[model samples]
Target: MAGLPSTARVVIIGGGVVGTSSLYHLCKAGWTDCLLLEKNELTSGSTWHAAGNVPTFSSSWSLMNMQRYSTELYRGLAEAVDYPMNYHVTGSLRLAHTKERMQEFQRARGMGRYQGMDIDVVGLEEIKRRYPFIETHDLKGALYDPSDGDIDPAQLTQALAKG
Candidate 1:
């Protein structure tokens, strides 16, 4: 913490993933005069227990785009930073046991299509093919998004902070 600046163009509150990410992006965009303040330790809040699921499938086009952007950003940041984010693009599957859930998935898939996301509603056989361990007997279908995955939120936040 030596040579701390007396003034910063941007003072971001919190040291969580979002706050650090904002600081990181601002720096990347050529704004080096920024400061991030955390009342407690970084990622000690909700980010610590987050599922870390970076699913791009959403009923809203805007949300889907934002998730997609975040996923891409995390992927690039993991490679660029010395610290590791443990990002895993293992994809995601949302199971639908009931007809109502199936319809919801279908609608979400439709929304994803407009957002340029490759999401699909797959039958039980396809689900079983992808995830053999899943118990697909009771499932009507599933929504599969190939780009969806996860990352270590704490590690990502650390990397962002380092940047």
Candidate 2:
């Protein structure tokens, strides 16, 4: 950034994970002459309120590609970089006791199967074995997306900015 001119080639509008991710990738791709302008502090707006869920298991090819890259980025933070992202890889469990929700889950599962994410159907017994903390009495079954997970928004933003 030192040798780069004052008039940067790219100007990013936000300071959240989305914007930070763009900036990180741009820098990695050698777009050194770029600037990200935040109207407020980093993670001050909607970024602060976001419950950081990995948006994987998408049906659309474009969404799937974005999520796949996002997953890889988060995994890199957990593995190569010393930047701990407060990420929990316990997985996502969508429970359904009623017929309506079950139908929706089935449709989504079929799509995820095509997308190649680690999403699958699980029964009550499997749910109990995987996550004993939940009370699964009335629940019929669940769609367990194994690669699905959560993250700490604050830490992730800071880490991406620094990285």
Candidate 3:
């Protein structure tokens, strides 16, 4: 800690995903006099246990937009920083077991379409085709979001800190 700066325009409290991301964004916006302090190593807290899923399927328009933004950001973050985030572009599926559930998925698909998302209400056959190991007999269909994916939480934190 001897070489640490004594003054900063902004001080972030932790080194987890949110904190590191905040610091990174601040620097990106030309706020370079920012410092981040952590009690332990980066991602030593709840961020270590996070699933790090980037899902874009949402019923709310605002939430869907946010999710979409997050997905897009994560997709390009690793390349921007020249760090490997282990981000996977594997799509997601919300299984619909009954007609009511299928109806709900249809509504969500329509909403996604309006937002220019690549979402579809796929039948059981399509689900099985995409994922052969899944048991789809009881499922009427699924709400599929091709943009949904996941990332390594620790790697993401490191990348943000590097930025």
Candidate 4:
């Protein structure tokens, strides 16, 4: 930091994980002079309420790519930044209520397949047996992505800062 200039060429707004991520990436990309402005404490904004569920079953390619990047970045954060980002891989279980919803999930799974994502359309029996905490009666089915899961924001922030 002492070798870099005092003023940064690029400025990032916000202080949440995303903003911190942008700052971290900028530094990693050789833009050490980049700056991030946070009006409040880190995770003071919408990020504090975030569920930290990183998924990869989006229909859009760009969004999916971003998810991919975030997922990978968080997964290898320990090696990349010398600190661990507490990411949970509990997987996501999206239950269905109607036939239409089942169709929608099928379409989503198809789209995920197109994007090379690991997604599957499961039946009510399967979901019920797996989770056992859900109400499947009168429902159609569900879409389960075993790789989807949550993350700890505080540890993630610390990890990024540690880098």
Candidate 5:
């Protein structure tokens, strides 16, 4: 790698997922003279050990959209580049043990539905059927999203840096 440039139109201070993604988007938006400064190697920080769970369910519309876009970008980047992100779409299940939690799940489901997410409120029987490992005796219900999953943060960060 070459030394850092003396001048840049934009300078990013970190090389984690967020910083690298910001650089990538800026470059994509026609800011090729941008530079990223990292005291250590990229993804060596918290990004390297992240769970990398990408869930599209959120109460806020903007956050949901950003997550959806990020998921789509990761999927496309994995296919477009040689890097393997280890991305998975295994989905996520949020269990509710009380009536209040179930109500919260209901609100989340409504919000997800409004934002075009495929979320569902499942009963205890369905939860048991889907997740046989879960003990649903004290559970009221659960929220299930088919688009939620995990990825390898290290690989993802490297991929973004490469982009």
Candidate 6:
């Protein structure tokens, strides 16, 4: 084990997503004398088990915007740092199996559109066209967000650390 430094300009605890992200942003902002202390390997705790689902679907405008920003950040952060974040733009869907669900999706789609998101309440045909192998017989429609996707939390943490 290496000895801890006697002092640091900024000492961040843990090496999870938040900690690494804070470190990265701080360094980007010219705060380079920062230190991060981790009890174990980065993302060895809850971060490794996270689903890493990035979705822009939310009833709250602030949350939706934040998620959208996160998705965009993840899309470019890896390339900027020369690290692979393993971000996949697989998109997301809120399937509607019944008339009530379809109505709900339509309302949510409207909200998304109002908030300047490229969301759509797509029909069964569109869904089938996008995913030919999906078992859509029970689905009426869906609210789709093309920007939604998934990312590897562990890889992202490493990329942040590299920054």
| Best-performing candidate as measured by lDDT | 3
Which model is ahead, 3 or 4, in terms of TM-score? 3
Per-model root-mean-square deviation over C-alphas: 2.6, 3.5, 2.3, 3.1, 2.0, 3.0
lDDT for each residue of candidate 4 in 78-160, tens digit (9 for 90 to 100): 77778766688777878788888888788878877776678899998899889788778877888988778778886787678
The alpha-carbon deviation from the true structure for residue 159 of candidate 2, after best TM-score superposition, in angstroms, is 1.6
**lDDT (tens digit, per residue) of candidate 6 on 1-163:** 5787888999999899989988988988999688998898899778999998889888667887777778878988988889977889988778889999888777767777877778899988999888898889899999989988888898999999987
Best-to-worst ranking by TM-score: 5, 3, 1, 4, 6, 2
Evaluated at residue 63, the lDDT of candidate 1 is 83
**Over 4 Å off in model 2, which ranges?**
1-6, 58-61, 78-81, 98-100, 131-140
lDDT value, candidate 2, whole model: 0.79
Which stretches of candidate 5 lie above 4 Å from their native place? 1-3
Residue-pair clashes per prediction, in order, are: 0, 0, 0, 0, 0, 0
lDDT by candidate, in order shown: 0.86, 0.79, 0.89, 0.79, 0.86, 0.86
Q: Which pairs clash inside model 2?
A: none
Largest TM-score belongs to which candidate? 5
Error of 3 at 128 (Å): 2.7
Candidate 3 TM-score, C-alpha based: 0.84
Clashes of 4: 0
TM-score of every model versus the real structure: 0.82, 0.75, 0.84, 0.81, 0.89, 0.78
Candidate 6 TM-score, C-alpha based: 0.78
Off by over 4 Å in 1: 1-7, 133-137
For model 3, how does the per-residue alpha-carbon lDDT over 21-54 read when each residue is reduced to its tens digit? 8998898899979889999899999999999898
In candidate 1, what residue range of length 10 has the lowest lDDT sum? 76-85
